[model samples]
Target: MIPIRDTAPCYSRPLATWGLIVVCVIIFVWLQFLPFEVSNPLIARFGMVPLRYSDPSWAEHVGLPFDGYLSFLTSLFLHGNWFHLIINMWFLWIFGDNIEDRMGHLSFLAFYLLCGLIATALQWYFDPRLEIPVVGASGPIAGVLAAYFFLYPLERVVLWVPPIVVHVPAIAFLGLWVIIQLYEATTSILFEGGVAKMAWWAHLGGFIAGFLLYRLFLKKPPDGIKMEDSSSFKI
Candidate 1:
């Protein structure tokens, strides 16, 4: 199911979320305009390649840096295609504002990067020798969804289920999403033998991080403001 929007409220501006979207869009567009020869190498250099860190000799043989920990954060701004970028950004747009509102700007940004780092780390843990470059914001965005799942359990999300739109409770929608990710991650590891296809493990890890760590980043709501307000702050 494709999510259209959520019914959660946000009183504060989501500047950090907007900034992240803009940065990702700009980088993606710039990569699209570059020659394939240049762009492909650039992506390989910046994208997270687990093997680069797992096998030092092989990484040096291919001229990759000695340390690639930066890619754990860089990969969040890089996407493989327009569809990949759109879906991630859309999900961020839908759920991110509320998260940012609750956490404040700087904390949200740090939380996002931390989640992305953990997501990629978990993916690397599962397939340390995989050579493919993992690039996308889905991991971090999954973290945002997790925060929304907890913060807005009583809220509803609007989804496009092909013929018509339907409103689903936040708990049900996000719970189903987590189940799908787990199923896909498990089947991919069992059948495909690795995560070279998609980083479902990263999504699961990010969701786990958000589920467990969101409270640490959250700030107190303004005086007299309750977090359960259902009136969303539109961008």
Candidate 2:
């Protein structure tokens, strides 16, 4: 399903969310202007490569930088193509604003990076020797989706499900997504030798991290407001 919007209202401006979107777009556009040879090498240098950490000998042989560990964080801002960038940014736009509104800007940004890091770590643990560069914002965006799922469980998500646009409870929408990601992650590990082009493990890991960690980052509710009460949510 393609998510259009959610029923949850944001009292504060999504400054951090907008800032992240702008940064990703600017980086993508700049990379597009560079030649494939140049851009590809840059991505390889900065994008998360599991093998670079799994085998230092091979990493040295391939001349991957010693500080390649930074890729865990840096790769979040990189994208392989326009579709990847657009879809990730769209997910962020859909889910991130409310998360930022709930956690406040800096806390949301920190939570995002922490989730991305944990997601990267999980992917690396599962496919330690895979020699592929994983780039894009999907991991952190998955985290955002998980946060939205918990914080607004009963909130309705407006989606275009083929011929009709319908509203579904956030749990139903995000639960389906979680199930799909779990299935894909399992299939990839068993049948694909844990080497699917898409990083399903990272997606699952990010969601898990966010699910377990979001409450810690959430801001205290004002006065009589309850944080998890969906009855007061806006449609």
Q: What is the TM-score of each candidate against the true structure?
A: 0.92, 0.94
Please report, in order, the local distance difference test score of every candidate based on alpha carbons: 0.88, 0.89
Task: Tell me the tens digit of each residue's lDDT in model 1 across 35-137.
Answer: 9999998888889998999998998899787653888889889999999999999999999999999899999999998999999999989878878789999
Candidate 2 Cα outliers beyond 4 Å, as residue runs:
192-195, 223-226, 231-235
Q: Against the true structure, what is every candidate's RMSD?
A: 3.2, 1.8
CA displacement after TM-score superposition, residue 21 of candidate 2 (Å): 0.6
lDDT by residue (50-116, candidate 2, tens digit) is 9999888998899895684899999999998999999999989988999998899999999999999
Span of 10 residues, lowest total lDDT, candidate 1: 226-235
Count of residue pairs whose backbone atoms collide, per candidate: 0, 0
RMSD of 1: 3.2
